[model samples]
Target: MTDWQPSALQLERIAYRQRRARRSTLIAVVSSVVLLVLVAIGIGSTPGWPRVRATFFDPQRAWEALPVVAEGLWLNIRVMLICAVLIVVIGMALAILRTLRGPIFFPLRVFAAAYTDVFRGLPLLLVIFLLGFGVPALRLQGVPNAAVIWGGAALVLTYSSYVAEVFRAGIESVHPSQRAAARSLGLSYRQTLRFVVLPQAVRRVMPPLLNDFVSLQKDSGLIAVLGVIDAIRAAQLETAIDFNFTPYVVAGLLFVALTIPLTRLTDYVARRQGWYGGGGGPV
Candidate 1:
């Protein structure tokens, strides 16, 4: 309102105010970071700190626990791989059944729906218990031990439902024009699905499928609840024996190590397939 130019001193004062504002912002940021670091250090330095430290840094204990951890890790990998293969096979069949439209297809649809509903509705732990305890109570011969039978079966049954839906969606995602084009070439429905629709749908859905596989790998730990001696269980046993937490941390790292490759592979495929562009090409 004064309509007057500032003196040199006023200009200097304005400059000083701007500099002070920047200084205050920098101080706030640095203080917040320092506070966070202090809180983290305080938490880490709590009781049993000495043993936790020794567990990771101690080479001898690490070496001693390696073999046991490796055994459990192997079991985890085996369960995941077996479940993945079974899920792919079972899921494809169910997806095909769900898409067919006819009198024969109706019963298959009902059965697939019930199967998916039952498995997906129940928690994995309950299913594992049924397999481990209930099946044995029935005295079914040729059933292997709980570890082999329950752990493996529950993983396959539970995940296959979700993956079946994934397959169904992928199969349906193929454009009707693609089907028409294939059929125009004298390809039958099954042949169109086998050669044209499924191949493209699968490539389009690879990223999600990989993500589901990773979830299956992590869920393999649920087997330990049924006494399957997976990596988590083995780590707990080792930790109790040694009275140290290092084994558990090491076991956790092993899981992270295993999953990191999968995440990277998913990213690689997503990028290669132009996932940003709606999975337009090969992954």
Candidate 2:
């Protein structure tokens, strides 16, 4: 048979759709440009704009601070990567403990529940301060009293609590029928979780997991308060020299740059997993 071709009406419909899409794209681009131009004009016309620009948007200071801030950002990258792994592993373990059945597992469930509640309720900054300062003050032998160690521990503890809840939600979302089916197939509970349930649960929660990591990536900057010499601390030092806020802007931009990719990946995964609609719908 010869290749099929669209009829006149079908061809007309196809052409109309293409034209509509192009028009929509053009309108979107024009609207965005006009809005941006208006915003720039408004800001530029402000009475204090010149002074504000000199203080916060100094190109020279930004250029000079770029190398230092970027180097400091590398520390954040290393810490975040290390903490992310620990968060996932600990979170998964906590989730599993919380989900375990039977009276024998009651104490584990209680412990997991209490841990999540306590950590989730407490402010992360407070946790960081407590761990970084309080822990060091105790000064037990063989314990690392460094702020970096305790601050990183604070991050892992707080983030793992939240991440554990996410994992637990994913685990509970896996239907009981799945567990029953696994049991019928002669798989033990652990085997079922390992081979069947966790795979699907983890897949379902991949988007949320990435979202957590994105937040973790940003929060890694908080360690600067503990004097970890990360991007924020570097920016603070630069600010002290001239009180110009350019280094802060630069550091913030770097974080946004890093987080944007993970944020986009999360959206992509959400769309793929049918948790989003028509490219991206509210989830």
Candidate 3:
């Protein structure tokens, strides 16, 4: 094998691009700092700034609340992980059902479509309340009605509907010719979907899948409304003790800390797939 290096002209182009990138970075950093400083000055000049800071940004209260909120944040993370897996599985199953061919699948397609429509249209908080409180109100025999359990179920049910649509789009994006080729190779319908279509579909849909998981990470905190004792709930309890909102800010920061990395990964994947757009205003 021959090893080749860039020509002098190519090297010059690379150097030019690096210089431009560094210049852009410096401008962005300076502009961002300036904007933040201006905003801080504007806000600090307001008479209520002192009260707002004392209520929401008290460093001592944040320090005291950190351990409690962090501990509760773990529950939110666990719920997100568990619900993410379930959402993908159930979403894919619904996608397959919706995409099935032939007259026999018509009813299934109808059912899947209806399910997605209903869940997507309904408010997620309502679903959570229904499952989390209303079902437990029945007190069925041998039924465990934990708030976390029902809250997680609510997340899975609602998110699976949206994700099913994403998966369906991916499945449909596969070329019909590929399925014919798989069939000509004596592959059954299931085998064609599993081996021929699904792999490509999944690859195409990965960026959106990561975006969904990112959203799930944030929504996982909503389980706190069900009295799950997750981070938000912990913050609420803390606020009641001293009427300080710093715990809520701490909880929010923790969520942002956890989710930002996944959001960046999603952006990277979207760019890698050439799906990057909507980054600029209309020309």
Tell me the alpha-carbon RMSD of every candidate.
10.3, 1.5, 2.6
| TM per candidate | 0.78, 0.97, 0.94
Per residue, candidate 2 scores C-alpha lDDT tens digits across 1-283 of 9999989999999999999999999999999999999999999999999999999999999999999999999999999999999999999999999999999999999999999999999999999998998988987999998778888899999999999999999999999999999999999989999998999999999998999999999999888888888999999999999889999999999999989888888988888898876664742
Candidate 1 vs. true structure, TM-score: 0.78
Quote the RMSD, in angstroms, for model 2: 1.5
lDDT for each candidate structure: 0.85, 0.94, 0.94
lDDT of 2 at 6: 88
Off by over 4 Å in 3: 1-12, 277-283
Give me the displacement of residue 36 in model 2, in angstroms: 0.7
**Candidate 3 lDDT over residue span 166-232, tens digit each:** 9999999999999999999999999999999999999999998999899899999888888889999
Evaluation by lDDT, superior candidate among 1 and 2: 2
- Write one digit per residue (lDDT tens) for candidate 1, span 1-283: 7789999999999999999999999999999999999998996889986765786656676667778987999999998898889989998888888888789779889999999899999998899888877777877688666666677898889888998888889988999999999999999988998999999989988988898998888888888877778888898888888687767777878899999899888888878777756645432
Candidate 1 residue 120 Cα shift, in angstroms, is 1.1
Worst 10 residues of 1 by lDDT: 274-283
How does candidate 3 fare on TM-score?
A: 0.94
